[model samples]
Target: MLRFLDAGESHGRGLCAVLEGLPANFPVNIENINKELERRQKGYGRGGRMKIEKDSVEIISGLSEGKTTGAPMTLLIQNRDYENWRLKSQEETFVSIPRPGHADLTGEYKYATGNLRNSIERSSARETAIRTAVGAVCKEVLKELGVTIRSKVQTLYGLNDTFCDLFDDGLYDLIEKSPMRVLRHQEEFMALVDSAKKNGDSLGGWVYASCEGVMKGLGSFMHYDRRLDGILSGALMSIQGVKQVSIGNPFYIATGAMYHDGITYEDGKIVRTSNHAGGIEGGISNGEQLEVYCYMKPIPSLLLKLPSIDLKTRKNSDSRYERSDVTAVVPLSIVVEHVLAFELLKEILNTFSRDNKEELLAAIEVRKIRIGEIYEKTTDY
Candidate 1:
């Protein structure tokens, strides 16, 4: 029953989010939440806005002494750039020419607003800041239940040069330092980013996310609506500009080999040897690390202008340029992690049906015992 809603415009005073249904006595980490926000603001090709805003979250309610109070949690992220936008004249207002590939014109039409400024303001990527905050909270909840979510950029604009030895200790470090969050061929990827920026264009990329320590059978195959994969995909696709989703491999290789993870037994425990199904099969988690990959389209608001029709005049015109990132895949990856964390938390809560951290952990322990008993009696793979 966990849910959240975010409100505010890109250049408004700030963004606000309200999260409800989180259990009481769950530990709240303000610093870690702030760090996630900071991560979302990083990445190569970011524009002047990143330079102006130092994002921080203010917890206004539902937290007391670093623990949830079982009430709705309200968060605030101030827009430091609001001062610069505050004094603009109504006549010298922002552009009315909606950029192609952006939500500007459609939002204006849907909201019945003649001015496109209102459309772009709310549809901006800036709203992801609040979502990051809410995801951070969900991360805290999952952490309490021994679940961890991490993400890294897989490729940048089809450049796969950032690959380090996947097993090397330096892989994590390299990913953390990378502006594109790529771990493979650093120099080549950097070159591509530089070239894109020089041309006033943008780049797209992919991200790989892994979740460890999630227990099996957290979702039910009995009903399609209750499926974990459906929930995860829906949550991920909600992010703007996400073009594709992959559970594990982007392409299915096996023709008639089931293409699904089969159950097995190991050390008197039910498990699977290979996770071709990406830790899920039959719409449920199978006690394996959940792997998800997302493809992000390049930022739509390009620095170089494009063609568009003026909303008022209905005449073709050059689209107006706005300060925007040349690439947002890196930050988008972090945002993806936050959203996935939220979905995982929802699934866990739905399966365990606990009201607090202690109760949830106890319920999980009991389920583990039940699975262990079943494992001992089953001999077939």
Candidate 2:
């Protein structure tokens, strides 16, 4: 199985990750990683920190001559802000008050620390930078195997707009270049964020991902832990400020008549009329476009402070103001794509042993043939 561990504080020296389980001879691209990092930092309403930090990855091990060495891969993303932060006095490092909708105070209690910075540094979404870098690497593997993954921002601070469709991979590049990462209503949404920033509030909204060319039966139904939906949803929920996750049709959209995907035949091939199941049923991919939705809460660091207690003085006070984006849903959609990509990589690795590029492709081809036989059986062929 593919596994990874991330280290380093938010404003510390840098972020580090050690990812293992990739087969040898798979190309690892530094330029791709850097490109994903650049996307993660872009988006409207971002704070000053985005201006200073230009994230790039340094590979310390598990790669040689641009390919994996069949060992654990080490990745590094230095925090440029750490240099300036180091110059501040010790008192400046401490945030006495916890911001509402943050892990600050509760994390402080759990760790029993005097300064909330202890918790703040690690809990900050800054950690996702390295995770995104790792996801870029995983994405390379999936891309080579013919799985195309992409995501789009659906809503911003409840500003209603048409959801971006991921069914067509041709538009993937356009969405990636887009400022708001939406197919429509970019100007209006940015204006809404501009207004929210003027009012010192933050915005949150929905994003969803889709995958094409994914073969059926990557995850298993033998055990609860082996369920693909359970694993994918768990990974999505772990993203900071992501409140909810749903596959295909969410609960509110599901009713007996409108809910289920109906199976059918098209031009001698079995097909699903609607993808209400999101490509996976019975804990396995079903050869349809895989889709999942996520909801992220507003960023907690507002220009105006929320009510809280000052840990230092033990008295009621407003939370300390911190630099933050008025809205981060745009870049967040990118993160969600890679996070989901990593999970998809895990399930693929579980199904195939690819010591080299050719083997991975051959394995995928074989799986598709076998799945075709299953489809024929379903169609009474």
Candidate 3:
């Protein structure tokens, strides 16, 4: 039942979020949320905007003395760049040309607005800043439940540097030390980002996230919406520039018996030898690390514009140029991690059906004490 929504523009006054359904007595941390916001703006190939914005959250409601009040929580992130655009709102600004890869034209048509500024303002990935803020809170809640989440950039450009083990528990600290959040370092990746920046182009890459300490039976197979993988994939797909999602291997590199995991009984407990299914089976979590992989397409904003049609003149022209990153894969990995955190937090709450923080904690303790009960229900591999 945990749900939240974000509002505000890319360069608007500020970004805001209203989150509801959190139980009373759950401690809130503004500093942790700020730290997560800081991570979202860090990367190897970020733009000038990162330098301009220092995001911090102000809890407007539903928090009293650093604890939740079981009411709707409101968060505000003031836009540092809003001062430049504040005066321009009074005048009708029109972007004659629509960018090819952005929602410029489609959003205009859908919203019945002629100015593409309206589309670009809200459609910009900058809004994900607040979403990351929301996820930071969820991450804290998950931490209390003994669940941890993290993400890594698997590869940049055309490199297939899958050096780290997908389900490694010890990689989180190392990945945090990385500028790009990946295990392996390649000079070629850095060079590509620099070259792309100088040449007015952009690059994209793959990111993977893993969740540890999730108990079994968090999702249901009865309904499509209730399925864990479906919900996770949907949340991941909503990220900007993300083109595809994979639970395990997207190409299914395995053949024959290698495609599935082998289950065995060990010391009176059920154990999974391998996790080819990425921890979820039969639309529910199976008490293993839940892994999600995503492929992000290159950012559309480039100094070198592609061919586009002018909305006003009805003539072909180069797309509008904007200051943008050469590659967002680094900070994007953090975004993916936080999004995954929110999804897991919601699923845990919904599955546990707890109405308060004490109840939720007790329920988690119950699951931990009875982990073998779920495993005993299904003995087959």
Query: Per-candidate RMSD vs. true structure?
Result: 2.1, 1.9, 2.3
TM-score for candidate 2: 0.95
lDDT digits (tens) for residues 43-158 of candidate 1: 87788899999999999999999999889999999999999989989776756788888898889779977778888888888999999999999999888788888778888887
Model 3, 248-288: lDDT tens per residue? Answer: 75646877698888888787687898887988998999888
How do the candidates rank by lDDT, highest first? 2, 3, 1
lDDT of 2 by residue, 142-198 (tens): 877778888888888677656556665566666766788877788998898889988
Off by over 4 Å in 1: 161-170, 256-259, 379-381
lDDT of each: 0.84, 0.85, 0.85
**Residue 129 lDDT, candidate 3, scale 0-100:** 94
Residue 13 displacement (Å), model 1: 0.8
- Clashing residue pairs in candidate 3 (N, C-alpha, C atoms within 3 angstroms): none
Going through the candidates in the order shown, the clash numbers are 7, 0, 0
